[model samples]
Structures are given as C-alpha cells and as structure tokens.
Target chain A: MDSAILLVRVLDFVGTFVFALSGAALGVERRLDLFGVLVLAFVTAVVGGIVRDVLIGAIPPASVASWHNLALAVAAGLLVFWFARAVARLSQPVLVFDAVGLGVFAVAGTQKALDHGIDWPMAAVLGMLSGIGGGMVRDGLTAQVPTVLRSEIYAVAALAGGLVVVAGGALGLPPVPVALAGIGLCVFLRLMSLVRGWRLPVARPPEP
Target chain B: MDSAILLVRVLDFVGTFVFALSGAALGVERRLDLFGVLVLAFVTAVVGGIVRDVLIGAIPPASVASWHNLALAVAAGLLVFWFARAVARLSQPVLVFDAVGLGVFAVAGTQKALDHGIDWPMAAVLGMLSGIGGGMVRDGLTAQVPTVLRSEIYAVAALAGGLVVVAGGALGLPPVPVALAGIGLCVFLRLMSLVRGWRLPVARPPEP
Candidate 1:
C-alpha cells in the first residue's frame, strides 16, 4: 500500500514537471513575460489536480498543500525561459513526455477519486478531465480553442487510461500493474494518433 | 445569522441569473446553436462560485450542490435564446445586472472565505477572483482575450467590494449593511467606468 502511494506520488511529480514544461513552452511561443510564463506553468501543472481535488472534497489540493509542485513548475518555466531555443529544439522529446504525463495523470486521478470513495463512473470522467484540464486552461488563456475539445485522440487516450484503472479496481486487480498498463496504453494511443494525423472533423466557419 | 445566510443565497441566485443572461446573449451574438448557448450560460453563471467554494473547502460547491443554480442559469439562457432581439435591446439593463452580479459575487466570496478562516489578504484576492472568474472562462471558451485581464476598473471594483466585506468582518460591523455597501460600491465603480470610458494604458504590440 505504501509502495503504491509512493508510485502515484512519483508519477504525479513527473506529470507536473512535463505539463509545466508544455505550458512554459507555450508561454515562450506566445512571448509572455517571465512572471506570466511561470504563472502559466504552475497553473497548467496543477489545475487538473486542483479541480479533481475540489470535486472530491480534498481541501487544500495536494499541489497547494506542498511546495514541491510550485518548485517543479518554477524550475520548468525557468528552464524554458533561459534556454528557449534549446527547449524549442527538443519538441520531439517534449511531445513524448507530455503524452506520458497525460497517461499518468489520467490513471492517478482515477485512483485518487476511487480512494476518496467516488463511484467509478464519475471517477473515470474526472480522470479524463484531470488529464485534459490543464491543457484546456492553457489554450484558453492563450485564446486558442482547446485542442482537447477538438482533437479526436487526445481525450480518447485519457479516457482509455481511466477505464483501465476503473476496470482493474472492479476486477480486484493489483494497483501497480493496472496503473502501468493504463499509462502504457494511453501513451501508445496518443503517440500513434499523432503519427497517423488522427483528428476529429472540424466544423466549417460561418461564411464571413 | 440565518438572515445573513439567506441574503447571500438570494444575492447569489440573482448574480447567477444575470451572468447567465450575459453569457447567453454573447452566444446568441456569436451565432452559436441553442445547446452551445445554454452551456455557455450555465458555465458563466456558476464557475466563479465554484472556484470560491473549492478554495474555501466548500465541498460539492454551492453551485454544483444546489439545483437552483442550474435552474436559474437555464431559465436565463432560454429567455435570451427565445428573445434574442429583445434581449439585445435591453443591453443597458443587462450591463447593470452584470455589474450587480460581479459585486455580489465578490462580497459573498469574501464573506465565505472569511467564514472558512482564510486571512484577509487572501480573502480579498479570492473575492476578486470569484467575481471575475466566470467572465474570464466565458470569454476564453469563446476564443477571446478575457476582459478582466485587460480592464483596470473591473477587477478593482470587485476587490473593493471584497475589501468592504473584510473590513466589516474585522470591525465587527453588521453583515447585511456591509454587504449592501460592498455591492453598491462595486456596481457604482463598474458603471461609472463604463460611462466615462475609463481605461488603463495598453502595451504596444510588437510589429508583425
């Protein structure tokens, strides 16, 4: 049980780091000031968890309860700001990490929801939300329609990851393997979709 | 105490209705479908209170916990959709209602935070956030820059409203009158700024 908790915590930290990196990268692309970039990074990294926590009655969200989350966000933001070109050049690696982050957050959020006595259905939905919420906010702040609302594969990947966790729990399976499988499946789906250019059909703009 | 709670609840409902109306109006202007317009209205009405409730550890959030909030939002949205032209002609009334909504949300959010044992400084900030959050989300979802991020007087009005609540709490003043004063000040500031065309300086955009 302790090990499982530790695993979730570690994965959560990793997820925060990767999400913060994505947010900071976007901030740089948008030419935000350093303070704005850091704020965006912190918000992206934790907004999902914060939303989940608030829903499940977890006061003082985990990220807000600890210093580590902010530290990671600050580090990621500073790294992006100080090494803008280098970070930009690392797009491929960043994408991979971002996918991993999404997978972990989906699984972990579902797990937490279940632990907090939420039903599986809501837990799964919250899990998907936890995976996508940060990016949604980030895009909204940047005045872009959120990719999660448009992309076919992004939300599917997270929902699939959540389902794995829910199914495992219902089947009385061990936690660690279920989580690992969920993450793996999510990353696989997300990456393959990107490679194949999978996208939902977009609505045409009204005639101007 | 009971009456005070009732006052907050009543004002909160009124706030929800006005905010929802504004959101629905925006959606109609944007030519969104009926379902989209309703969604926007509901989101705009409740998001601010949801944020406040979550931060203050109010679980199931007042907006989410009560059916009345949703009902009010739906009612307001439908009214706008069915009477689009009429609603447009009522823009002056709508703006006044919107400002009133902002004022009540700021004061109520601050009062709740203080009740939850939050410090004055943070309570004031949260109050302003509660007032502005809904519009920010509404604008962001519609792919526009949020007015709260740009406008000087809007947030200031909300902050002052919050400060009034905090001051009342600190000075052991009666709740209802303090709340009334807060709301009145906020509405006055917001409306005056609009009438006078008051604006903060904007940074120049970089040459494309």
Candidate 2:
C-alpha cells in the first residue's frame, strides 16, 4: 500500500478506538448495561462513516460489509468496560484523541466524496457530516442534545477542514499535503475552542 | 400512474402530514423556536423514507427530491405551531393518525426495497427501518431516547408489517391488496399495544 494510504488507515483505527472509548465512558456514566454500552460504542465509532457511505451510494455501508472496523470498535468498548476507572482518569487524553479523529475523518470523508464524483461543495458538506455524524448518534442514543448542534465549535471545525480539502483538491495539491493541512486546521480549531470555552450563541426564547 | 401507485402516493402524503404534526407538537412542548419546530416536523415526516432510500441506493433521497413533500411537512408544522392548544385537545386523533402513518410507511418501504431488487429478508429489515427511522430522528433531536428502542411496540408493529409485505410480494399477490394487508396488520398491532400497554423486555443491568 502507498505510504499515504497506510497513514490514513492507521489514523482511522486510532480514531475509531478513541471514539469508542468516549462512547463507552458515556454509557458507563449513564448506567447502561454491558450490551447498551457496546451498542453505543459501536454506533458512535461507525455511524458517521455509515451515513456518509449511504449518502454517497456506497452500498451495504463499508462498516457493515467489513468485520475489521466492527471488531476494533467492539474491542475498544470492551476495554473501556473493563478499565472504566482507569480510563476515567485519562479524560484529557481522550479529548485530544477525539480531536485527532475528527480531523482525520473530515478530510477522509471529503476525499471519498470527491472520488465518487460529487461536487466540491457537496464533498465539503459530506465531510462535515461524516465527522459529526457519529457523535450526534451517540448523544442521541444517550438522550442528550448532540454536541455539534449546540456546542461552540464541533461541526464548524469539521466544516473548515472539509473546505480546506475541497480547496486543496481543486487546486491539484498533493494528496498527503492536502490531507495533512485539513487535519491540522480541524484539530487546531477544535482544541482552541475547547481551551477558550467558546460557544455558539443559542437562540433567545421567542416572545409568547 | 397505476391505481396502486396513486394510492401509495396519497397514503404517503397523509403519513407525512400526521407525522409532521406530531413532530411539531413535540417541538411546541419543548418550546423550540419556529425554525426548530419546522425542522423537527420536516425530519419526522421524511427521515424514514430517506434512510430506506439511501440503503436501497436510491440516490438523492425521494424526500429531498420532491417539493410537494417538503411543502406538506412545512404546512403541517406551521399549523401545529399556530394551533397547538387546539391540536392538543385532539390527542386521541393524533394517536390514530400516527398508527396509520406507521403502517403505510412500513409497507411502502418494503415495496420500494423489493422494487430495487433487494432480497426479501433485507427488504423486511429496511421496511421496519423505514417505518421507525423518522420517529427516531425526531426524538433524538429533542434529546430523548428513541421510542422505537424503548417504548412498547412501535418497531414491532413495523417489523410485522414489513414481514407481511415480504411474504405477500414473494407469493405473487397483487400489490394493492398486499400493501393494504401489511398496513392493516401494522396499524392493528400498534393500536393494540397502545391500548394494552405492551412493552419489550428491557435488558437487565450488568453486575457491577
């Protein structure tokens, strides 16, 4: 495999693991049983890509067709289940890992959309969708408002990364550099928002 | 259009209207602003079909591709927003409407899957998905556990309806009669569950 492809694959696995961990942690906090925790983790790790694949006409969804991704997600969930206390102490690290995953998925999704002959604008949209879709489903399953819909910077960062990929790809940039740039932009924006505690303004209550 | 196709379209619009009304009512209860109400209504009215269409590789999603569907959903939302107090008085009617919508979507989804040459088992699954997908998204956006996952018999009704469609199709039955039988089965099961308070067993909490 090409080095670029290899790097992407590695990042994908890393992202999936950390996302699953976060989901499992949430399940534990919610006092969900083992099955619910596993379900949440699997859905959180894979739903984004599945939604993207479906939107782009990838039949059966890659996550459903392949066992590798499902196994990794399930393994991560089981690990968290077993080491809940220890993993709880790594909250900061988990956040960082999640940011990395967000960046990687955003660029990867945009690239996939482009490969499928989608226009750049739609590719960018699909990238953001791919990046935020899992977290949305995770929060939904846990009965919480999705962070992307209400948070300060989640989807925006993903959108920024996707736009970068679209621009870079459109300009005939090298694949590795384009991917790296998008990832960097997304991670930087996410971390900055987290540290700054910035938030998107909520709509004021309508007058009765 | 064939008479069967026309009937399907009429039922589709009826389902969309009632589903949208329910979603809009929920938005009102949540005190969501006008935009949120419209969004909830639109999602509830169409998401199930969109999900089914995507799974079956029907590109562009029938819901997104049609202005008529969009208009009806929006109108339904607006009606609820403006007349919520009055609408609330008709709770009994709403339940009946919701059951009808559920039944029709279940059968329609299965038929569409078969038309796309999907196998019967998968078509049945997709049919259930189509019947329940919109409600899941609607509840999720409102920060609630999906009714299908936790409630009495929502998804069961859909699954039963889907199976009927699959069986009827496989037996070379006429489309109109098969579809009606599936719808009747779904509505009956759902209403019975509502009246009798049927519930799926919840998983036991894991040993701490």
Candidate 3:
C-alpha cells in the first residue's frame, strides 16, 4: 500500500513538472518577464486541480495544502526561463509534455472525484475538465484561442480516458489497472492528435 | 419588493453589458478574429459569476440558464469587432465601463451570497472575487500579467464595497440602501485610483 502511494506521488510530480514546462514555454514565447513565467507555471501546474477540488467542496484545495506542487512549478519555471534558447531549439516539446500531463491529470482527477461520491458521468466530466482546464487557461492568457476549442481533440482525449476509468470501475477492475489503462489511452489519443494535426471543423459564418 | 426585484434585474443587465464591453475591447486590442472576440466576451461577462454560483452549489449558474447574458456578450463582441477603429478612438471607454462593471458585480455578488446564507467574511471574499475574476482571466489570456494583481486598488475597491454590505446587513439595514452605499464606495475608490495612478508597492526581487 505504501509503495502504491509512493508511485502515485511520483507520477503526480512528473505531471506537475510537464504542465509547468508547457506554461513556462508559452510565457517565454511571448517574452513575458520572470514574474509572468512563474505565474503561468503556477496556473498551469495546479489551477485545474484547484478547480476540481473547489467544485467537489474540497476547501483550500490540494495545491494550497501540499507544497510539492508549488515547488515543482517554481523549479520548472526557473529552468525554462534560464534555458529558453536551448529549450526553444527542441521543437514541439510542449506538445509532448502537454499530452503526458493531460493523461496523468485525467486519471488522477477521475479517481479523486469518485472518492468524493460523485456519479460516474459527472466524475468523468470533471476529470476531463481537470485534465485540460489549465492548458485552456494558459492559451487564453497568451492571447491565443484555447487549444481545446480548436481542432486539437484535447478535451476528447481526456473524455476518452475518463470513460475508460468509469467503465473499469463499474466492472470491478482493480484501481491500479484501471488507472493505467485510462492514462495509456489518454496519452495515446493526445499524441496521435498532435502527430496527425487532428482538428474539428469550424462552423461556417452565416451568409449575408 | 417587486420594485426591488426589478431594480436588481436592471442593474444586472447593465453590469453584464459593461463587462461584455470590457471583454470585447480587449479582443479588439488583441486583433482577435470574430470567433475569438465572441468567446472572450462570453467568458469575461459571465465566468466570475458562474464560478461564484458553482462554488455555492448553484448548479448550471445564471449564465448557463439564461440566454440574455449570452446575447449581450455576442452583441458587444460583434460591435467591437466591426468598429474596432472607432472604438479605439474613444479614449479609455473600456476602463470606465470596466470600473462600473466591477462595482455592480461586487454589490450583486455580496447580496446573492448573503441570500444563500453565506457568512459576511466569506460573502465579501466571494463578492470581490466575482468583481475581479473575469478581468483577471481576460488579462491572463491576453499574455499580460493580471491587472488585478498589479492594480491592487481594483480588488481593494471591491473589498471595500463588500465590507460595507456586510456591515449594513449586520446592523439590520435595508438591502437597497446597503447596496447603494456599497456600490457608491466601489465607484469612488476605483475612479480615484484611476485618476491618481494609485498602486500597491510590489515586493522587490530577492538578491541572489
């Protein structure tokens, strides 16, 4: 049991780092100052989780209770700001890290919501929201259309993973296997979308 | 009592319009496409109130239930986008509208939270949050530091107004007078800050 807890903690830290990196990368692309970068990192790393907890009546939220998330965000922010030139040279690192972050957050959020006694469908929706909310906010802050609303299939990836978790739980699958399967599906779908440039078609403007 | 309800509805509509205008102005400044402008307007006008409602267990929130707010946002968005140059020529119209919107939201949020049985301090906090939340989001999405954080007076103005409401409620004052006093204080403080360039001192960066 202790080992399982430890493993989850590790994955959570990795996910935090990835999301922070993606946010910091956007800040750097926009040439924001150090304060701006750190702010963005914090927002991306923990805002979704905060929103999830608040919705479920979890006061203060996990991000405020645990220092690890803040530490991870700050560290990632510093690293990205200091290595902006080198990091920018590696094209599309943000996309890769964002996918991984989404998968981890979706599974974790679903598990947490279930623990709070919310029904499966609502839990799935909240989980998907937790997975993509940060990135959506980050994109909006940077004056770009939210990637979720664009053709990226981002929210859909989270939705697919959450549904897997819901179904697995219904079938009485063990939590470990259920989480792994959900996360794996999410990561696969997100990556595939990025690689293939999958997008939803825009609604046509009304005729004059 | 019927008159009071009518007044509240009128104030709410006016607040919604002002908030929508602020958001549309931002979209125009950023040169967002029509869809982006509409999205920003929708988000800025309703996101804060929606968040406050959801936090207090008001499901779906007012923005989701009523189509009026959505129509107001869309109208403002289209107007701003189509008359971007003309709007820009009107010096500081956004700032004026934003300040009025903030005052209106602060009073309304406090009153609603009290109606829902929330205590004074928490209600005040929610009121301030409702007033500033949308602008924070709007600024963040535009790749700029949140004005609420930098313009310390903005949140403080809301806080002052909310505090008045709490105090008046505690003293068994009528709701109408309490609301008017609160709104007046918010407007006065915001305008003073704008005209005097008042700002909070930012913490200096630590020396390495």
Candidate 4:
C-alpha cells in the first residue's frame, strides 16, 4: 500500500518552499540578522518532515540530508532579506503561505505515515504534527508561544485534513485525488480562519 | 565497547527528574494551569533523550516509551503545584537543577551515541544537543527566548563534556569513569558560570 512515494516527495517539496517563504518573511519582519533569517527559513521548511521521519524510524530524514532543500530555503531567505521593505508591506501574505504549507505538509506527512504502515489514528497525529511542528519551532526561536497553541484555529484544521486522507484510503480511493482533497480542506480552513478572524478560545488572558 | 548501559540508564533518570523539577518550577512560577505545568515537566524531562534517540535511529525513544519518566515528571509537577509559594522562593535552585540535568543528559547522550557506533564529532554534537534540547523546548513553550541561545555558557559546557567523553574513549579509557569525568566537568563548568556570572557574548541587544 506504500504506493505514494512520488506523491509524498512532490508534496514535501511544495510544502518546503511555501513554508520557507513564510519563515523567511517572518524572520525579516522580526528584523533578525541574515544568518538568523536563513536558519529560520531552513528550519521552518523541514523540521516538520524531519520530526515525522524520526518518529517513523526513518534515519537521517530526507529533508535534513538534501542539499536541494537547503538551496531552496536559502533562496527563500535571500528573497525575503533582499525585499524586506516590500515583504514587510505584505504581512498578510505570510499567513497565506503558511496555510498552503500546512495543507501540503499534512497531506504528505499522512501519506508517508501510511507508506510506513502507520495506522490511521497515529498516522493522523503524525500528519497534524508534520503540518504544525515547523511553525512551532520557528515561533520558538523567535521567543513566542506557537500560534497553533495560542489562539489560531490551526492544529484542528491540520488534523481534520489528515483524517480525510486516511479515511479516503480506507474507502479505496486513489492516493493523488485523496491527497488533493486533504490539502484543499486544510488550506480552506486555515485561510477561512484568517479571513473570518476566527480564533480558538484561550482559557483566559495569561495571568500577566 | 558499550559497557556502560547501567550508567546511561541511571544518568538518564537523574537528568529526567531534575529537568522535570526545573520545568515544573518554571511553569508554576509562570502561573500556568495544572495541565500546562505537567506538560512542561514531561516535555522538559524527556525531550532531550527523545531527540537523541530519534537521531540515533532508536524507535519510540526509551524516554517516550517509559511510564516511569512520565510518573516522575508528573510527580515533579504535582510537587510544584502544591507548593508554589515554596518553589517561587527558590528561583536559584531551578538553574542549579537545569545545570545538573544538562550535565547528566550530556554524559548519557554521549555514551549512547558511542554505543550506537557514531563517530566522535557527531557524537559530541548530538550530546550537546541532548543536553540543551529539552530546556530549549521548555522555554519555548513558555514563550521566551531559549536561555541557552541567549546569555549562557550552556552549549559550551555540554559540548566540552561530550569532547571529554570521546577523548577518553580514544585514549583507551574505560567508559564509566570517562562518563563520570565528563559529567563532572560539565556540572563544574556550569556551576562556575553561575557563580562567576559568566555568559556567552551577544553582538548586541536585539534592536527594539
């Protein structure tokens, strides 16, 4: 059943690029040094996949070992660094990129988990983690609570998408189409939250 | 050559307990809920070991698969929760615990990497990562710059300890004594740094 290796690879790179862009944008916006920006770009782009692979007993995670991913991340970082003023002006686009990245990462992560014979429930968990883990580490290096853990309607959407993919697989659906549907739903939910200003409720304002 | 399995196991538990205590203390000081405190304790206690395990191609990391570690973390959390005022009064102790945890984790991690047949340079790096990884994640969850990345002699101490272990191995020394020497050096350096107000240099404060 691990028939979706190519699909996972394609989606992984797509997610990497978009996530790198978002990470670079955030680092630039936060006024980090160029080195810091590049670090953010590289880490934000690949950490999710790395974490997923590590958990699934994949050694030397593909993203970590690939120079191509590094080149792409550096390219994204440089673009943001060189266009700081312009990038700064387009703050809203960062979230859009993040949404796209989340969708693809989730779908890819789920498919990879399935490829490795992970069951649906644990697979969905891994998939959702694959979607959000990078952004969490990105925010961490910036010294902030992860938006996913704070007020964003983020993790739920990722989990939902992962569940969709696994469910489709159970129904004997084609991998590519099922993956596409999962990505669509994840992106839709994330973007909708941004547009609608929807937020997960905080128990209370942190006790200051 | 892997003659120190017992040493590693002991060190791991020691590190886990102290790290969990420090994390629990931080969470209580930060006035987080019980759930948050426990999460912090659990994560801070085991994440370093988990990361080290994952990198070494070990499945379901010993720390992650161990209920004893969880019980210890929860116990630490509960202690802090029930005695918040007492814990809040002992801020300096938290740093001490963190330093101890770092030392033990570094030693344990170095030994494990060597046992896994990893080479020296990579083993040392992995060891340092193990020492610092948990504390970094703990600080991140609380929405702050990792103290290790900022003004601390943290990574250096861990790395140096790791080097000592590897050097001892290369010099044809026994594993257990070498590990203890490594741990001693790490703890000494960290403690001295605390006493002398030593810190890693920052180029300049981040521009506000």
Candidate 5:
C-alpha cells in the first residue's frame, strides 16, 4: 500500500478505538448489558462514516467495506465488558479518550470529504457531522439530548479544525503537516472548552 | 403549479400531517414536554424525505426546500398538544393514520427517485428508506430499538409497494393507477401486520 493509505489506516484505527471506548464507557455508566454495549460501540464508531459515504455516493462505505473497523469495535466492547469494574475505577480516562477520538475523527472526515472533491465549506460541515453524528445518535439512543445541539463547543471545535485543513490545502501545504496542525488545534480547543466550561450562550428564558 | 406538482403537494401535506400526529402521540406516551413533542413531530415528518433526497444528491432536500412541510408539522404539533387527552382517547385511529402516512410517503419517495432517473431496484430501496428512516430515528431518540428492525414487516411493506410501482412503470402503466395500486398495497400490508402481530423471525439465540 502507498504511504497515504498506510497513514489513513492508522488514523482510522485510532479513531475507531477511541470512539468504541467512549461508547462502551457510556454503556457501562448506564449499566447496559453486554449486547447493548456492543451495539452502542458499533453505532458510535461507524454510523457517521456510513452516513457520510452514502451521501457522497460511495456504496457500502468504509464501515461495511472493511472488516477491521468492526473488529476493532467488537474488541473494544469485549474488553470494556470484561474489565468494566477496573475501567470504572479510573474516572477521567474515558472523557480524555472521547475527546481524542473526536479530534481524530473530525480531521479524518474532513480529509475524506476533500478527497471526494467536495468543496471546502461543505467538507468542513461534513467533517463536523462525522465527528458529532455518532455521539449524537448514541446519546439519543440512551435517552439523552445530543451534546451537539446543546451549549457545548464540541461541533464548533470540529468546525475549527476542518477549516484549518481547508485553509492549509488552499495555501498548498503538505498533507501531513496540515492534518497534524488541524488535529492539534481541535484537541486544544476541546480541552480548553471543557476545562473552562466555555459554551455558546443560549437564548435567555423569558422574564417573569 | 402544474397538475402533477399540485398532486404531489397534496399527498406530501397529508403524509406530513399523519406523521406529525404519530410522532406527537409517541411524545405523549413518553410524557415529554411540549418542546420535545414538537421536535419529535418535526423530525418524524421530515427526516425520512430529507435522507432520501440527500442520498440522491439533492442538496438541502425537500424538508429545507419546502417551508410548507415545517409549517404543517408545527401546526400538527400544536394541535396534538392542545388535544392530547382527546387524541389519546382515539387509540386505533392514530395507527390508521400512521398507515396512511407510510403508504403515501413510500409511494412518493419511489416516484421521486424514478423522477430523478434512478434505476428500479435502487429506487425501491430508497422508497423503503424514506418510509422507515424517520421512525427509526424517532425510536432511537426515544431510547427504543427501532420497530422496523425488530417488529412487523414495516420496511418490507414499503419495498413491496415500491416494487409494484416499478413493475407498473416497466409495463408502461399510467402514473395515477400505478400510484394508487402501490399505495394501496403498502397500506394493506402495514395494517395487516399491525393487526395480526406479523413480524420477521429473529435470529435464534446462540445455544447455551
């Protein structure tokens, strides 16, 4: 395989692992059964990419086309199930993993859209969707409002990183440097937002 | 507007109203707030058509293009809220309306795909997707496994109806008769499944 393909594979696996872990942690937190955990993990890891591919006229998409993504998700699900108690003991690791997954997935999605000849603005939008869509679906399935639609800067961070990639591409920057910079920007923005409790202001409640 | 366009508008409105009512009923069953109810109604009435359009490379989709759909959903949402108790009292009436909605939406989706020059098999698949996608999303949001995946021959009924439309088109049948027969088949199948507890067999549990 070419170096580009090799890089994509590595990033995809990382993104899949992080996404699966976050989903499994949420299922464990909710005390769902093993089957539920696996389902959540699979959905979180693959649904966004599947939707993205379908939109871009790619039949079957990466999730269905490659067994590796499914294997990674299933493996993560089993590991989480077997080590639920031990994993639960570490309080903050899950959140950290989820943030890392979000950054990786957002950058990967933007790159994929750009590869498909989608325009920069639309590619950025698609990237944000890819980062957040799975989490949104997972949260909805667990009876919680999606974090994306709430006050969180989650999608905003993805948008920022995606725009960076677009800008870098426009300036004729190398792909690796552009991707690394974009990913770093996303992680920094997301971590800072979480630490500072930064959020977009909502419409104020009507005065009494 | 042309006569054909006028007919599509009428069917679309009727389908939207029925779908909105069904979604509102589900919100009431879940005891959600008014905002939640409206959101459900809006999503259920439009999401499937939106997905169908997006898949066929129709940007923004009908949900965004036609403001009337949103208005209709909001109106139905308000009506349901105002008459929640009364609506709840009319138990099976809601199901009947839902069946009508399914039939109309399925036929409309298939016809729209055909209009876009998609092949028969793909159009049938898209039709089924348009019929069931919203319900799946709604069920996922409500934290229930989608009924289309678990119970009743919901998507299959849509597929069967779409096949009828496709066959009729291949046989050079007129649009009006083809539509009527297609919609009728869908309604019959859906109502029969609902009444008779018809469901596809689940994969047998692994041996102990």
Candidate 6:
C-alpha cells in the first residue's frame, strides 16, 4: 500500500515536470519573455490540480501551499527556457510523458473526488476535467483551440480512466489495483489515438 | 436594505449581458462557428463569479447552479450571433456596460469573500479577480493576450474598488454605502482611462 502511494507520488512529480516543459515550449514558440514562460509552465503543471482541488472544497489547494510542487514546476520551466532548442527536438518523448501525466492525474483526481464524498458520475467528470484543464488553459493563454476540443482521444481517455476507477470502487476493489488499472487504460488509449491520428469532427454549419 | 440588494442584482444582470455580448462579438470577429460564439459568451459572462465562488469554498458555484445566469449568457450570445453587424455599431454602449459590470463585481466579490471569513487583503485580491477573471478567460479562449495584462485601467480599477470595500468593512461602515462608494471608484476609473487612452507600458527586455 505504501509502495503504491509512493509510486503514484513519483509519477505525479514526473508528470508535472513534463507538463511544465510542454507549457514552456509553447511560451518559447510564442516568443514570450522569461516571466511569461515561467507563468505558462506553472499554470500548465499545477492549475488542473488546483481546479480539481477547489471544486472538491479543498481549501488552500496543494498547488498553492506545497513548495515541492511549485519548485518542480518552476525548475521544469527554467530547464526548458535554458535549453529550448534542444528540448523542441524531443517532442516525441514529451507526448509520451504527457500521456503518463494524464493517466496519473485522472486516477488521482477520481480518487480525491470519491474521498470527498462526490458521487461516481460527478467524480468521473471531475477526473477528466483534472486531466485536461491545464492543457486547455495553456492553449487558451496562447490563443489556440484546445487540443481536447479538437481531438477526441485525450478527454475520452481520461473519462474512460475515471469510469474504471468508479466502477472498481463500486465493486469493492482495493485502491491500489483500481488506480493501476485506471492509469493503464488512460495511457493506452491516449497513445493509441496519437498513433492512429484519431480526432473528433469539428462542428459544421447546416447546409443552407 | 432589500432595495440595495435588488439594485445590485439588476446591475449584475445588465453587466452579464454586456460581457456576453462582447465575447460573442469577439467570436464573430474571429470567424468562429456558432458553438464557439456561445461558449465564449457563456465563459465571459459567468466565469469571474464562478472563480470567486470556488475560491471562497462555495460549493456548486451559483453561476453554474443558477438557471437565470446561464440563460442570460446564452440569450445574449444568440442575440449577438444573429445581429453581428448591428451589435458592432454599439461599441460605445458595450464599454459603458463593461465598466458597470466591473464595478458591481468588484464590490460584490469583496463582500462575498469577507462573508466567507477570508481576511481583508485576500478578500480585496479576490474581489479584483472576480471583476476580471471572466474577461481574462474569454481573451485566453480566443488566443489573445489578456487585456488585464496590457491595459492599465481595468484591473487597477477593480483593485481600487476592492481596496475601498476592504477599508470600509474594516472601519465598521454599513454595507450599502460602502458598496456604493467602491462601485463609484471602479466605474470612474474605468471610464476615465477609456476617455484618456491610458495604458500601462509593456515590459521591455533589459539591455545586456
């Protein structure tokens, strides 16, 4: 049990780093200054968690109070800022890391919602929101359509993961196995969609 | 008094309608589809209040739970969508309404934060956030630099209003008069800036 918690914690940190890097990369692409890059990185890595925490009545969200998370996000931003040219070449690895982060956040978010006595349906939705909120905010800040809105895979994968967690919990499954299964489902679906180039159709105007 | 609450509510509704119209207009200018226009309008009209509600631990934000707010936002969006050319001609009225919304939100937000047992400093900050958060989100969704970051007047006006509310509350003044004073300060500042063409200087890179 302790080991499972430790594993999730380690993955959460790694995920935050990769997400922050992605945000910083966008900042560089947009020709933003150092402050802008750092702000983007911080929001991308932490805002999803903060949003989820706030929705579930978690006061003084961990993103605001936890120095470790803040430090990690800022460090990731600095690293990207200093080595942007080198980092941009590694987009493939970054996507994979983002998938991992999404999966971890989905499971963790659902768990937190459940712990707060939220029903499974709402918990599942919040879990998906937790996975996608940061990226949406990041893309929005840069004046782009969020990938989740245009792409089917990412949000669907997170929602699927959340569903698995809720179902497992309802069936009286242990926490460790349930979390692992949810994470596995989300990661697999996300990576698969990327490889397959799957996307949701954009809304179209009716033929006049 | 009951009359004061009623007056604030009426102003709130008016402010929401104008903000929603502004968002919908931006969507039309961006050449987005109907769905995009509605989404932008909804976010712009209600997100500030939603954000404030969440920070103060108000579960199920009234913005989301209240059918009236949602309907008003959606209705305003539809109005602009169907009459884009006409709405564009009324830019003068829109600015005036935006300023009013800023004032009302600033004072109301500060009051709500104080009601939630938050300290005066944080309450003031939250109040300002409530006034600007929706517009920031709207611009972000449309991929623009939030006006709050580049414009000198808007956020400053909101903060000034928040400060007035906090100070008044601290001094044991009555809520009704204090709110009116805060609102007056915000509206006056906003309109003055618009008339004078005031803007904050953008950050520049330091010389090497």
Q: Model 4: clashing residue pairs?
A: none
lDDT of 2 by residue, B1-208 (tens): 8665575577678778888987888888889999999999999999988877777777688688879889999999999999988877885644665678788888888777777777676676677777877888888788777766454677678878989988886788887888889899999989887998865433332445
Span of ten consecutive residues with least summed lDDT in model 6 chain A? A199-208
True contacts kept of 2: 0.17
lDDT (10s digit) by residue, model 6, range B22-84: 777776666665655766787788888888888787876665434577678879888878877
**DockQ, all models:** 0.12, 0.12, 0.06, 0.12, 0.06, 0.12
Model 2 chain A lowest lDDT segment of ten: A3-12
- Using lDDT as the measure, the top candidate is 4
The iRMS of the candidates, in order, is 6.1, 5.7, 7.9, 6.1, 8.9, 6.1
Error of 1 at A44 (Å): 3.1
Find the 10 residues in a row with the least total lDDT in model 2 chain B: B199-208
Encode model 5's per-residue lDDT on A1-208: one tens digit a residue: 7554565557668888888988898898899999999999888888877776765556678899878888999999889889998888886655776777777777777777777777666677667767877888778788787755444567778878888888987898877778778888888888887899876533221232
What lDDT is reached at residue B36 by model 4? 60
Residues B73-111 of candidate 4: C-alpha lDDT, one tens digit per residue:
888878877777766666475787899899889988988
lDDT, candidate 3, A130-206, per-residue tens: 88888988886777867765546677789788888889878988778788898899998888878887554332322
Clashing pairs in 6: A143-B143
After the best TM-score superposition of candidate 3, give how far the Cα of residue A191 lies from its true spot, in angstroms: 2.5
- lDDT, candidate 2, at B83: 93
Across A1-208, the per-residue lDDT of candidate 4 in tens digits comes to: 3468988988998999999988998898788899999999999999999988888878789977769899989998899899888877875857878899999999899888877777666677678889988998888788767767554568778988999999998999998999999999998888777789765422222232
lDDT of 2 at A164: 92
Evaluated against the true structure, the overall lDDT of model 5 is 0.77
Give the candidates in order of lDDT, highest first: 4, 1, 3, 2, 6, 5
TM-score versus the correct structure, for each prediction: 0.62, 0.60, 0.57, 0.61, 0.59, 0.58
- The TM-score obtained by model 1 is 0.62
- Candidate 2 positional error at A132, Å: 6.8
